[model samples]
Target chain A: MIDTVAGLAADPSGSTAQDVVLRAENVHVEYDGERPTRAVRGVSFELRRGEVLGIAGESGCGKSTLAYAVTRMMKPPAQLTGGSVVFRDREGRETDLLALEGEELRAFRWNRLSMVFQSAMNALNPVTTVGRQFDDIYGAHRPEMTKSERAERTKALLEMVGIDAGRADGYPHELSGGMRQRVVIAMALALEPDVVIMDEPTTALDVVVQREILDEIERLREELGFSVIFITHDLGLLLEISDRLAVMYAGEIVEYAPAERLTDARHPYTQGLLRSFPDLVGERRELRGIPGSPPDLRGEVVGCAFADRCEYAFEPCRAVTPHLLDIAREGAAGWRAACHLNDPEHRSSVSDAEGPQS
Target chain B: MTALEVRDLVVEYAQSRGKPFRAVEKLSFTLEAGRTLALVGESGSGKSSVLKALSRLVTPAGGQILLGGRDKVPAKEYRRAVQMVFQDPFASLNPSHSVDHHLRRPLLATGRARRGTEADTAVAELLRQVNLTPAADVARKRPHELSGGQRQRVAIARALAPAPDVLLADEPVSMLDVSIRLEILNLLDDLKRQRDLALLYVTHDLATARHFSSDIMVMYRGQVVERGPSDEVILNPKHPYTQLLAAAAPRTGATRAEVRAARQVRAAARSARDAERRETVVGDGCRFRPRCPFAMDVCATRPPEAALGGGHRVLCWLQSEGKAAA
Candidate 1:
């Protein structure tokens, strides 16, 4: 089906030419269990070629779930409850990723889309040499390539990322944290995928190493012209690397805007995130962390998920769950936030701290 | 009087097969009892090595660790007055042990608080000091039951159990996610102020270091590159390494795309450096000459002399030459 779509889309006379590489509509993901959790709710986004979109949230915000859902990596108990993640292939064919089965899904895993995870170091086989690992990844994806050809290609890729080709013989343990991360990145880039998803790839490394690895990712994206969906809890790091930012509360994106808007957000939750983030530059102010922890995800949340902790939450905020609404009062164009404070009709019900609590 | 003074500290590991690798070398600093001194450096730059030396976790080969103006203090004495809070609160706390066990053991081990109901009350008070409310609720819970922030509070409470006069926090907030890091840092600052305790904050983050400490020591390759008041050193870094670190910080106003581009260039250069494995001659006038942006021919001979002033010290030959010219 994808092949047919691609063939038709590639035809000059065909009317289906779209610039978007990936589009996920109304995505809902649920974990499988005797008592399962709904990890993602109504998540939607579009990835254009060469654009880096960052998913920012605390743990359990379903950011990672969204990544899995898009890549069709959802395992047992984790089911895509609803929505379509449409991927436009090189030939401009659109296919729903969730609908793919077995070989069709596996075919796109590294070639069209790839993901680098937090524990990517553990992803490498300790017994095998780095060269062998690269060979295996390339070999598994492209069995048509001979051994010597694969080796040459591997060396070229390693050199592209500034990694010494000599270290290809080193085992996983022999390399440092930064080097291992680079190797994982190199493997992700071997297929030259159009879309790359990274889930907290540098969370374990020191700040220096974190900076180094993010730099490498940014470089690869620039050189390869691939779109990136980078996930992490560090707002500072996200702000430093992402072109656009998505602020997720619970299982929903509360706000989506250019990086500047996030630095000065209109949404109350986003405001809290900006204030809570420790600035590497600027005078040291008393760091006021969010007063309360994230709401329990095991159960349902009513009204605003952040109301209990928000200093500015009001009555309407507690009684109703605000959907993404555009407000003209703020200078943010196309910048939307999910808060009743911005709705004129809802403002009457909201009054200070007494608005709502759970 | 200085709360603690370390002179010519050198930490070396002696493995069976390999030659001893000196992790920290000729590192020296002093902190006043009420002032906070931050040791800032990248990984493998010996900030943690300095902390381990103070805690007696790793013995120094050629330095004297002085506490309260006295050299060579006993480990137990140091333990009572110099408690350390490790980076990871979750990993630091034993999973099986309840919060009560975590706090009470340290109190009893140091003989600060006795067993039974009295120990429990003291534990409650310590928890209160770190702002853990309804302390009893957390007392019965294991580490996994609490949030990362709450577990860190417990760890801080446990460290305070020994009633330490000096606190050594090594990357205390680094392991924590950014949202909660400030709370922990503020707690450390407030505690240090109230207790008049000398603090040795060891970390690679200059932003947090500037926020938490009064004095700053920028280290590289086990040597002190620049040392001064935290504000002066961070805002007006004289050392090339310090300048590089300050430049590397992610600024809020800078767009991610721009920072990413800049970082890509830096990583490429660093990778090239790593491949070379350039050696720095120990007896050279300037150890950082190879990586230094402004290396002069004079840096090949004698090691740089220390330029000391009011709570500021630097060992760069540039500063020395500037002083002599003036």
Candidate 2:
């Protein structure tokens, strides 16, 4: 079904195609119902071989939906409407992910790109021991391995993620949430996949535990040299860990930039998000959150989806749909923003003191 | 005036085994009108237990909850005096009932509003207070019709329907989106000041906790290991556990190096705590001894409270020993 328009042309993601691990090109997803919700609208980005790309947005912005579409995990009612996901193997062979089917799709996942699902830390089976569950995953993916080889691999993976290898016999109930999450991550890494997608992996956990898990993932990514696509709504956190960030609003990528530049954001929605939260290490100041909620994406959206809530929305913002355009200063690498203010003709009158250089 | 005072609060869950699990102990604090106190801790650190004991969700094994200098107040009056704003506003509001019903019943039951006309007027006023415009339209809609932030606002308005003196919020904004969190938080802060309501905030986000509250109490496994002015606790932490938390906080200006350093601190702390918790026999002294890097011989017994001046205090052997050395 996705064969149409897929494998169109290669996405130009700053980096050359050789180093790009996973490239999502113009994807769209919808939750079909009485009023269909367009969850993802033409989202695209590239994952470098050993870099971390962060996708961030609040609930209903479709960050999670995009992940589901790209990973072939979309269920009924949630349809992957359009676009392409190209996963480049370590052998430099490109496979159109959306086109994979049956056993080919099954073999593609876990062996190439694995995902540690949202709240996956607590997703371990209670009745089965941690080791047994890991062995089962190995049994499915690596049928050629002997029983002892699978057991040895499980212990090694557990140890790599900082879990005690001996605790493999323990049930999910006996281990803490953090430990359970570690086991899930270990299982994801068991196949030594080239890319690991973690969606809100540290959410709802204790601060100490959240920090500990992030540290382990970073260490593993460094040692194994696999790329990561870390998804979360915590913008501040994404800014800290991710090398590049894609800010989404109303099911569209509003801003894509290097993490540091994102702080001095080019898009008003991204700026609104940065200004929304109270800073931990700074002088206290008054903060005004973006007024009004996100616009409903269930129906036909006219012009800019964020214009109603945007502080700088003008006449053109209501009439013209803004596409992602390069808003970076001359010579700067990768900064694209979907806002009329970035357009020379439609730029807002009150220019930022640190606005982009042509 | 002190709007609410809690003394030696203890919350214990009865177990089928030998002893009941004491979820909270030695927790005592006072909330004066027009002030915000943040209780900062991880899960199972007794943050919920504290809120639960205050709102009368679970009967505390021991404690005196004093509102206006009386602990013997009736259940009905206590309910009116103390109100709670729970997390997950989607779950907090009734989907079957209209917003009007959610607020009207509480307003009339507390005698804050009369029947029919007066009740309608009062509900409109509450909705207006939360910035839910054209109260007429919002009042008729069910919880499903409203957005998450709006639902939270409705929950806040409902909590305020009875005109409570003390407001206990347990992770109220955690469920909302990143862009709308400040709207709800700023609203809560504004209400706290406008109504002079004593606010007790419970959360794990160190940054927001320190930003919103005048005082911050850091909890570890049922006991408060550190307490001080919010800025002081966050900036110059004494306890090792507090330092770990400060390191874990996500900040705007943290460079990649700083993030890596924080990660290093967390990884080291996790391993150290894991090894110590398994080997150390932490009898009754400091609950954090297992995780405390600077654990000493006297940690087996309760450490003496050391005053760090300017309303700051810490329950750690390191602080006390350092004070003696100084």
Candidate 3:
């Protein structure tokens, strides 16, 4: 019984004049096979211009799938079942991303949008030199550029990511894991795309190296003024780098809010995820593991997906799916959560202690 | 009593030419019953080498591993007392073999249980201990049938089948999801307390190490840079490497300014000379000197271990000189 219309109208972050770079409407992604799995279910969100939007979830929660769908990078077995992805340019020109095919799609990629895959260190060609990889990208997207110009751009890109430009002559195996990942980042930014979708870009790297790479990305984003969709299972990292955060649970965005305001998350799933990892600088408390496993996506989800595991789950949670609605709370301007407990009518049944404090 | 004590343990890998590359150098630590020690380091930092050496998976080139204050223990007894739970559970467990077969093998080999009913009972108990409920169903399934967390639990259960005094866990929960990781860690903690087993938890993540262990040892380039109580090392790190790791780790409630400052500090610490010095300098000087922000002329030579009181020790010239520069 959440008020969707009122909630949508009260979005402080979203306005008519404000620029939204990308918008996904009712996105649905499914893995097609003998047992078809609905990976992403009715996910909708708008990526603001020049802002880092972090999508945080567990491995099977479909964060990566959503990223792929938005960028139109879904391959066989993984198909975008339903959704319209609209990419809006600076001049208010809107293009349907899902409609782009073949040559148009190829041109759209790297020119307007780029992606840094997970374990992207392995994404580099082991046999080819780092410069050759950059050459390939430039060759495909900007064939008009001369060979010497490509080389110069390659060197500049390498230098931008804090790697020695001379090392571009070496193969991927010659460089360290961190350096290889940086090369991937440099290549992703080579075309200067308006949007970059990074899927757990730093997951394989060590903490120190991870920090350096993220810092480099933060610096580059500031300079280039490009929007980013950063997807990872690590909430702490998402909180640190992202301006806005989306918490996905069982193929849907359970909670969406500004990063700073996520500390007071209204969704029970979000709270559980936050409590699962030990804080580096807080009072040591026993980490509470969410009791049950994630729902099997192959089966039909009758109600709220997290209902089985949620401590605050009530009758409505088990009977009806909750829609993502803006929850009024202090210091949480545009905060929204998909939970029955957040609804005004459902708040009375639940104890005040369990309800989110405004 | 000290269940296992490794004194100046050194492990080397033979290269094609010149000197054999030392994977672990003069690494020493003691594991007492009922206590957990976390070995924290990045990749290629010789953390895994230490684990391999202790479990006798890889023979040590130098130094000795004493068991119960004795230089040597019988091979059979040693196998029963020391067991290792590997990092990758998927690869560690045989895919073709059932969970029952995996658990029973250790128990039978260690003479913990005889054939038939005895082995079955032991397997069931082990499964329950690791929190894999409905033991009969889980025991019948293969490794592939279980989730990542369940597979890790089965691996732990198999390791515990022999009722080992010391457990060597190498990045146990790193492969699992964040929600399931805590369950495994909690299970390990419970096992240690219940059985009084000495546990050596190895991981590159400092945050989890601080939460699960009582003592923390930081390793860098096959050497112990810092060793102390987990709280002391995590909160008030003395070594530059440990400080860098602390600063680099993404923590809850970390501010943008703090993250930015840490990045700047790390950038300043990565000297061009350090990269070059790594290739040429060998056993003569402190391994961390080149990258150390507080490095001095004295750091060119190996610095003696400095006692920082309350079981905390740091290997740095500045620390030895009481400068507290870093």
Instruction: List, residue by residue over A14-86, the lDDT tens digit for candidate 2.
Output: 5777898888878999999999999898887788899999998888899988888989999999998888899
Collision pairs in model 1: A32-A77, A240-B256, A315-A350, A315-A355, B285-B302
DockQ (CA atoms), all models: 0.55, 0.71, 0.68
Chain B TM-score for candidate 1: 0.90
Q: In candidate 1, which residue ranges exceed 4 Å CA deviation?
A: A1-17, A327-333, A348-358, B255-285, B302-310, B322-326
Per residue, candidate 1 scores C-alpha lDDT tens digits across B145-173 of 98888888899888889888888888898
The candidate with the higher lDDT, 1 or 3, is: 3
Which lDDT values do the candidates have, in the order given? 0.79, 0.85, 0.87
Mark the regions of model 2 whose C-alpha exceeds 4 Å error after superposition.
Answer: A1-14, A348-358, B265-281, B321-326
The residue-by-residue lDDT of candidate 3 on A1-358, one tens digit each, is 2244345435675455347888877789999988899999988777888999999999899999999898888898999988678898889998899999999999999889999988865799998999999999988999999999999999999988988899889999988888888999999999999899999999999887888899889989988999999999999899889988999998999899888768777888888888887887678887777778999999999889999988878888888888887777766677889999988776678788865453
Q: Estimate the TM-score for candidate 2.
A: 0.95
The global Cα lDDT (0 to 1) of model 2 is: 0.85
List, residue by residue over A1-358, the lDDT tens digit for candidate 1. 1322233234332223466788877788888776668788777766767878888887777898899888888788899889778899767888888889988888889999998888767978899999999888877799999988988988888787667888888899987777788888888889989888999888877676676677777777777799999998877777888877888878888877667657667677777777766676687787776667777665677888888978777676677877766545454554567777767688676564533221
Report lDDT (Cα) of residue B28, candidate 3.
86
Could you give the CAPRI-style class of model 2?
medium
Per lDDT, what order, best first? 3, 2, 1
